[model samples]
Target chain A: MSSKSTTKRADALRSIEAIVQAAAECLGRNPDASLSEIARAAGVGRVTLYAHFASRAEVVDAAMSRALDRGNEVLNAVDLTGDPLLALERYIDAGWHLVDQAQALLAAAQRELPAGRIRELHAGPAARVEALVARGRAEGAFRTDLPIAWLINVLQAVMHSATEEIRAGRLNPERAASHITATVLAAFTPPGIPVPEPRGGA
Target chain B: MSSKSTTKRADALRSIEAIVQAAAECLGRNPDASLSEIARAAGVGRVTLYAHFASRAEVVDAAMSRALDRGNEVLNAVDLTGDPLLALERYIDAGWHLVDQAQALLAAAQRELPAGRIRELHAGPAARVEALVARGRAEGAFRTDLPIAWLINVLQAVMHSATEEIRAGRLNPERAASHITATVLAAFTPPGIPVPEPRGGA
Candidate 1:
């Protein structure tokens, strides 16, 4: 509550981010590595690392939390109100934009920790997208067979994969994101439902 | 050209599959293990292993190649003639199925082989998917801004991630695949396009 305490807390938070960033870098390079090495990457003594977090497991969890926070921020802000499906396009674009920033560390983390809570955290945008899917389905915009959660699960996987491809230089990020969005839409568009051109009323 | 040669090749291919499967098991248990140990897991003598594949890299590649072949089969059999979009859905579904079979080895191999030709050899499905996207765009069913190649890349990555989530037990395969397909679809479906749910129309 006091200035000194606040200062210390801020410093601790900064240190934690530093540690997570370092671990992310290390994990990116060596998916199979030890905790001590991660500590070295973070530029802190093992004891200091231990003082903040108890074990390698804790550090990983913490780093994942930070990563998820960044990922969720992107998912959370997607505008989903207008032209429901097209709104979803903007949402996907938002995700790519967010992912672009933490691309390297995030890819490594996703690869090593596929089902971790980081994914759960990234599920934030997913929830909004699901709501939109349900609306689309109920309103006859999306496939009714695509139950809400199932839809999110597939897209989440696709988003992660798309990010990796862009990072690997095999695909351009913007183009990849757009194509993925369109392809997925085409797959789920209930047969007979042809997409209208931009701003044309269906 | 003889029956004996055909049998020999079949036997050799089976052996390689076993070897790769064993190597995956080993990597799952021990990420930093060596080839001699993998040979032991495969029940092949180290000399015989070398005879079949010159190095660890080759063995890994062959293992991935086997996995890639399975993926190729799934893509090849998917009927793309009907609704270009329905074909797309079946293809994505097939992808979900295939990624389940040898995903662990794919993961381990991908982690190590960044510059690998895994994508090049696996481009068969990508090309088809790209064609579908082009078709959709031309049909006014998809976005003109989306790049065909990048869409394939992202979908491929997400497919891998979703499969791993299923393997990890955090996500049910059915639910995850459906969710992924929907989200990706939302992004891809053109603004105001009506997805036809034309019943009884595979």
Candidate 2:
């Protein structure tokens, strides 16, 4: 990308991210919180907020767009070893932590986040994760003939939901993540995969 | 078991449930929505609110106490079909619809609900669900070797978060529940389970 184009791109991304994050926090207080609330939180005047976002729905859509980007970043960064269960745990941990950091905003993103964009973002990484799971299944490290898509869908839920629980103080972060990981693996890992001993080896 | 005892128990349960549901609706609008808010929403005066709940925390706890009961009801009502995926779907669908009926209160409950009581309530149904999932893995319906606790924890997340989505209007009720159900099942079902073609074969 040319420097001018790159600079414009960077600035646009930054502005968009700030607006979305602010909106997320604003909406966290109330899903129905007003556009002015988002404007104030984002440090943008009404003109600026409107300059970037045309309406509440657009603002929500933009916010969701950024959150998905953040989600994808985490998905990319997490290490995925051959074991589907292990990779899933790491993925859930990374994903939840990302959402937790952005919980105020991500809270709103889940509902308004565009499915088409999310699916596109997920397509590459989800495929890789599925491949890992498939390999594990083939090797009998995970269950064979299990629906690969189901496992992926549930992991997304686990990460997304566990973060909410932690944000709400219903679960400690580590325990919450572990709890989700375990819950999923139990349903999917091959029959002989031993249940993880309870933390602290109790 | 006597009719008098049963009637009294029924009354307690109904009153408590009503108060909590009302409180939850208020909390949804305002995180800091007060005992007075809850009282008004519950359609009881402050005096009546206190008659059932001793404090704001108590109100939240009482409400969660009821919510946890409902969660169990969802768990118990899940049909245990030979196909774990189908059985799980029924469980999710039942729970999915109940989430937003009191999401704000649920969000609050995570903070104020009594830990000991909540933990106790969580343990029973959680185990049963885990057992069902474990059987799914053993019978080759789901991925094997994942932790049961984790699955249960994440299930709560998807259920509650979807409520946020629907309330925010990002997802319509039918689509939100279907998306969540499909996503969750994808996470656990064995690889052979096909992603249900969107719109049930259109």
Candidate 3:
């Protein structure tokens, strides 16, 4: 509670945040990158990294947790008060940015982490997506035949694929985010409804 | 040619097919699996493998080429004569089967092979898909607002995602083929048109 202790606490939090960010970046570039490499990238000492993470697995966990936390923040910031369809688009735009930032970590988490944990990490955004899809279906804005779960999976699929295309240099990052937004929104739109043309006519 | 020479030619072709199949299976299990391992799995000796493939890269190329050839056969077999929509669905169903079989090899190929070669391998199927989409668009069964190239990309994306889901065990293989077929067909379907319900309603 004292000023001295509070200052120490703030410094510790900053160091942890920096370490986690560096780990995510390193893992994104090389899934097999070592702990020492991550620490060096973080500009932290071995001792400091050890002080925060007990082992490599702990580092992986912290990095993935931080990335997912940031993704949830992005998803939450998409105002849910707007049109349900627009809300879905905003969520995907923000979601893909997080994906672009932490793709290696996300892919690693899918392979290395427990399914339950991965599901838990995704729960927040998934719930928001489900709600939006349900709203769209109820309002007859989206297809009713497709289950909410499947629709959510399709959205995630598009995001992952778009990210892959960008990383592979098959898609231009400058235009891909909006391209994904348009493509995915159109995919989600129900039959009997027409989506607006791509802005600027191509 | 002598009968003995003809027999030798048939045996050589069989051996080559067996070696390529073995390489694909081993690479699927371990992307870093060695040439010796592939040879052993093929029930052949190191000399035989060396005679067939000059190097690891050659093996990778052969495996990928074999896989894509099999995929083309699947796509070619899809009767394109019926309703365009039905033809598209049948193509997807058969295509995913090949994907399921060669996924590991296909993924390994992406990392191990040249991008130009990979594109070349995909060219046949991509052209077929473009033709199908064009037919649907002409019949007013598919959307025209999206470019044929982009639509083909979406189809590939959906296929990759479905395969990922199946590999992750998040989706059942027995059902995944149809699930993918439905989802992808819907993606290709114009916003204002409704795809028929799955054979059995979900």
**Which candidate leads in DockQ?**
1
Off by over 4 Å in 1: A1-43, A54-57, A70-83, A86-90, A111-114, A123-125, A135-141, A174-191, A196-202, B1-42, B47-55, B67-97, B124-145, B154-165, B168-193, B198-202
iRMSD, per candidate, in listed order: 5.5, 8.9, 3.3
Clashes of each: 32, 33, 1
Q: Residue B118 lDDT in model 1?
A: 68
Candidate order, lDDT descending? 3, 1, 2
Q: Identify the leading candidate in terms of TM-score.
A: 3
Q: Rank the candidates by TM-score, best first.
A: 3, 1, 2
Candidate 3, after superposition: displacement of residue B7 in Å? Answer: 12
Regarding TM-score, does 1 or 3 come out ahead? 3
What TM-score, over all chains together, does every model reach?
A: 0.67, 0.49, 0.78
lDDT of 3 by residue, A97-191 (tens): 88787788876775567656777777877888888888888888777666566677778877777777776677777666666666666666664
Across residues B1-202, which tens digit of lDDT does each residue of candidate 1 receive?
9999999999887777778877766765554557889888898778767778776767767666666766787688878766655666777777777677656666667656655476665677668788877777787665555556555555665667666657666676656555555545555666566554433322
Q: Fraction of native contacts in model 1? A: 0.69
| Worst 10 contiguous positions by lDDT, candidate 3 chain A | A193-202
Candidate 2 chain B — worst ten consecutive residues by lDDT sum? B193-202
lDDT of 1 by residue, A101-184 (tens): 556555445555545555565566666777887787777766666555455655565666666666677676556555556655
Query: Which scores better on DockQ, 1 or 2?
Result: 1
